[model samples]
Target: MSMTITEKILAAHVDADEVRPGEIIDCRVDFVFANDITAPLAIQEFQKMDIPQVFDPDRVAFVFDHYVPSKDIASAQQCKITRDFVRAHDLPHFYDIGRSGIAHVLLAEEGFVGPGDVFVGADSHTCNQGALGAFATGVGSSDLAAAMALGRLWLRVPETVKYVLRGKLQPWVTGKDLILAIIGRIGVDGARYGAMEFAGEALAHLSMDERFSITNMAVEAGAKNGIMEPDDVTLAWFRPRARRSSAMYRSDPDANYADVRDIDASALETVVSVPSSPGNVVPVREVAGVKVDQCFIGTCTNGRIEDLRMAATVLAGRKVHAETRLLVIPATPRIYRQALEEGLIQIFLDAGGAISTSTCGPCIGGHMGVLAEGEVCVSTSSRNFIGRMGHRQSQVYLSNAGVAAASAVLGRLAHPDEVVRAPVPV
Candidate 1:
C-alpha cells in the first residue's frame, strides 16, 4: 500500500524499520518546545534531574508568547522564569514576547521543523505545525519533563485519514469553514490518535495562512497531527524568510489511507462552529437572524497579516453594527507593525473595531474582550469549548476573519462574500 506524507514521515521517525497505519512504534522525539505558560513547570521538573545541561540545547526552543507583556502577576512571574531559564541555558532559539508570536507559527516560520521530525510542545495547539509533515502533538507537564530530561519521548504511529478537497473554495468560505464542516461530519473526536492528510487541487491554491487555519484545528478533531504535502505554495511562503535551510515533504502516491473524505470545494459555503464545541457547526444562513454582542478578528489561529487584510477588505467604508463590539488583535509585534504600515489598522479603527495588544487575549479567556452572561460573539479564533472565552453562559461562534468582520458590521451572522469581493492587500 502507498503511504501519505504523514505516514512516510512517521515511518522514518519510527524506531522500527518501518511503520504502518494502525501500528504502534516506539520512536524518540526530534525536538521539544516550551513556552512561558508551560515552560516554568517543565523547568522546575528539569531541575530535579541530575543532568547539568539539556540533552541537546539546539533542539529545544523556549518561547514567551501567551501572555506577552504580562497581563497579570502570575503571568509576569511566568515570563520572568522563562527569560531567565532560556538565557541561563544559552539556548539557540529563545524568543522573547515581542519576537514571539505563537510557538508553532514561530517554529515553522523560523525553519525549525521538517519532514519526519518528531516534535512536541506543552501547548495543546502545538499540533498546528503538523502541517509541515512532522509528528507534532501536545503533551502534559509531566511528559514535557521527561522530554526535557532525556530529550526523547515515545510515540505510537497513528493512522492517516485523507481529506481530498476538489474544486475551488467560495470567496467567503475559507479554511476555517472547511475544518468546521469536517468536524461537524466526523464529530469532535472522530479522528482520535489519527493523522489528517489534506490533498487535491484545492490545497494547491491555498496560501500558508489558509493552511495554518486548517492545521491549527486538527487537535479539535482529536488527531495526533494534520499535514499537507509541501508544494510551490509552501516553498514560496518559506523561501523568502527562511533564516537557515528549509525542508519539504511529499506523500507516496501508493500510500494507504485509514479513512478518506472527499470535499467538493465549490459546494462549501461560509460555515460556523457554534458554541461549546468546534464540531457544533452549521451554515451561516441557518443562524443569520441571531444577533451578536461582540466580534473578534484575531488570534494565533487566524491573527496573521493575511487575516487582518481580509477583515480590512470586508470593513472598508463600512461601520460596525452599533449593537456589536468589534475587536482586532494582531498576533505579534511584527504583524501589528505591518498592519500599521499597510494602513489595515486604520480601516479597522474606522470601522469601530477596538485594537488590543498582541496576546492570546479573549481566545483563552486570558484577558480582554471577555464575554458577559448571555452575550454572543463571532470570532476568528479557534476553539469554542465550554467556558473557553469566559462565563459558561456566553456563546462563541468560530469562523474565518472575513465572516468575523462582516458579522461585526451586520451585528448578525454575515458572509464575507456578501460584504466584500476579495481580500485587501496589506
Candidate 2:
C-alpha cells in the first residue's frame, strides 16, 4: 500500500488515498499553461469546443518566450494571438517579454506553483516545475485545450524510478554533470514513461536552481516527470514565492519503486553529450581537443543566475577566442537584472562575450547564435539532435556552464581546470 511521491500526489487529486502505477485516473488540474509557441494552437482547439469561458482565469497562464520578439511575421502573429487570448480570458498570470521570464522559471518565481499540485504545460520541459514536489508534465496542445475548458484531465499513472544521491560534489562539478553521467550510464529513454524521483543527502547541498536544471531535462530521458520531495531546502525556496500553500507530500518509507539508481555525487566528472544525442556522453578529457565555433549558456536547462555565476568564475578577466563566438543568455528578466547588478554582464563584455536579451533564442537556434554549415559548438542548453541548433552538418557538444566557459576561451572543448584563472578588469 506504500506509494511514491508521484503516486501520493495524484491520489489526492483524484479523491483516492493511494493509487498504484498504471491506474487510470481523472484528476483536477491545479494550473494550465502554454507558451507563445504552443498556446495559439491550444486556444484554437479550445474555441472548437464552443467553450466561451475558461475554467479559472487565475489558474491559467501564458508566457511570451520562444521567439517572443517576433523573429518574423509568423512569430509576431503568434504573440498577438496569445496576447488577445490572455486579454479575452482575463488571465492574470499572462506575461510578455518585458513583464515575464521563461514560462517555467517565471511561474516558479511568481508563486504560481507549489508542492502537491498537478501542473500541465504545453511544453515538454514543464516537468522542470517538479523540483517543487509537484506532478508537472508536458501535454500536447489538444490535452491543454481540454484542461483549459474543463479544468480537468485524464492520465495513466506512471511508475517511479528512485535516485538516491550521496556525497558532496567536487568543485566545478554540478547537477548538470551528475545528470549527464546518469543519462550516459542508462542511455536516453532509460526512464521511459516513469517518474524520476531524486533524493538523498546530496539533494540537500543542491540549490533549487541546480535541481531545476536536472528536472527540466527529464523529458530527454523520456520520463513522465522528475520530482524531488519537499524538504527544508524546498520550503525555503517556495515559502516566499508560493501564491498558494498546499500541504506537502512525501513518499511512504516503504514505497514501491520501479527501479532505484544510486549515485555518488563526488565521483562525477565534467561530462558532455556528443552531437545528436544526450545519451552519447563522455568525460571532458575524451573530447578535450575537439574544436567548437560557438559556446552558448542559456535556455531552461542551465540559464539561471547560479549558472551565470559559474561561467563568470571561469571567465572573469579573460577574453573568449577571437574565432569563437560566446553567447550568454539569462533565462529571465529578473536573472538578467541580477547579473547586471552583480557586474556579471560587465565581466562577460570585458571578456569579449556577447550578452543577449532574455529569450529562448539561440538555444532553439531561432536567432542570436545560429551555427553555420559544418560548425561545432559547446552549449549548456538541452537537446542537440541533428540540426537542433542549425545546419544539419553543424554539431553541438552539450556541457555545463563550467565547460562552456572554458571551451569558449580555447575555441575547443575543454574543462574548467584547464583554463587559466583571469583577473576581473578594474
Candidate 3:
C-alpha cells in the first residue's frame, strides 16, 4: 500500500503494515510535552491516574514559556503546581524561566523532535515539529496526561493534502507570507482534520527556520498537522542536534491525496493578515498607511534568528516612529545569544526597539506589549483572533518580521522596501 509521509510515520509508530485515513490506531509516542499554561491542568489529570511516574522521564518535557516570570499570582500558582510535579518525578527535561523559550522552538532546539517521530503536546502549535517530517499534533490537556502516563496515543489518521511549490520566492517574501496567502485562499477551516503535506523543488530555497514558521501555523488552517519530506536541508539541520536515531520518510509516488494544490512562489508578495482573522489577508500595499501603535516580532512562528536578522536589517540606520513602539523577542536562549553575538541586539536598541528575554509574553496577551483598546499592532506572531493580544477592540495585523520592522518605522503598515531602498534578501 502506498502511503504519504504522515501515514508512513504513524504506521511505523504503531508497528502496522499500513494505516488508512480515518482509522483509529494506538501508537507509541516518541515525545510528549506541555507548557506552563497547559501543564498545570495536565498534571492534575496525571495525578488522578495514580501513576507513580511518567512513562519515560527522558521523553516528557515541561516548558515554562508563557507567562514566565509569572504574570500574576494566578499564573505563579500554576507554575508552582507543575514545578512540584516535575521535582517529584525527577524529570530532567524541565525548562524554567531563565532556560525556557517557546515550547515549540525549545523542543526542536534541545533535540527532542526529529523526522519519522510521533510527538504530541498540549499546545496547538505542536504541529510545528512536523516540519522535520515527523507526525506531530496538538491535543487537549487530558489527552496530554494520558500520553504522558502511557507513552502511547490513539489517533484517527488524517487524510493528506499535498501542496507543490514551484518557482522562486520574491525578495522580502517568506514562509510567513506563503502561509498567510494559503490561509487567505482557503479560509480557516479549509483543511480541518487533515494533514497538509508540503513538497516541490521550492523547498530547497527555504531555510529550516522558514520551514518551521510554515509548519507552526498549520493549526491556523485547521489542519491536524503540516509536514515536509526530509531532504538535505532537513538532514543538515537535524543531524548535528539529534540525540537519538531518526528515520526519514517519504511519500510513495502513488500515494493517495485528498486534494492537491500547486503554488507559484514567484508571484507571492509580502502580505499581512488583517484584524481578527488570519484568513483575512491582503497585500502589504493595500493596508499601507494604516496607523499602528505597536509592532511585535517574535513567537514560535517567526522568532528565529533569521527573523531577528530580517527585522534588524530593515531597522538599521533608522529610528522607530515616535508614535509607535517596537518589541523584539528571540525565540530561545541560544537564538538570543546568537543575536547578541551578531550585533542584531544593538541595532534594535539603537532603533528605539525594546528587547525582551525569551518568552511568549506579548504573543498571548499575557504581559509585556499587550494592546490598549482600539489600538493597532503589526505582529509576526501566529494568530490574531479577537482579544488574542489584549483588548477585544484592539486590532492585530500579522506579517513577517521585515514588514513588522518597516511598519514600526512608518508608524503604520508599510512595505520593507519603503524603509530600505534595495530589496532585502529573504
TM-score to native of every candidate shown: 0.93, 0.98, 0.98
Cα displacement (Å) at residue 179, model 1: 0.9
Q: What are the per-residue Cα lDDT tens digits for candidate 3 across 91-151?
A: 9999999999999999998889999999899999999999998989999999999999999
What range of 10 consecutive residues in model 2 has the weakest lDDT sum? 417-426
After superposition, the stretches of candidate 3 with alpha carbons farther than 4 Å from their true spots are: 422-426
CA shift at 43, candidate 2, in angstroms? 0.6
- lDDT at 359, model 1: 71
TM-score, model 1 to reference: 0.93
lDDT of 2 by residue, 152-259 (tens): 999989999999999988888888888888888877899898899999888889999999988998888889899999999899989998787686989999999988
Q: Model 1: residues >4 Å from true position, as ranges?
A: 243-247, 421-426
Task: Write down the TM-score for model 2.
Answer: 0.98
- Candidate 2 stretches greater than 4 Å from native: 420-426
lDDT, candidate 1, equals: 0.81
Better of 1 and 3 by TM-score: 3
lDDT (CA) per prediction = 0.81, 0.89, 0.94
Clashes of each: 4, 0, 0
How far off is residue 234 in model 2, in Å? Answer: 1.0
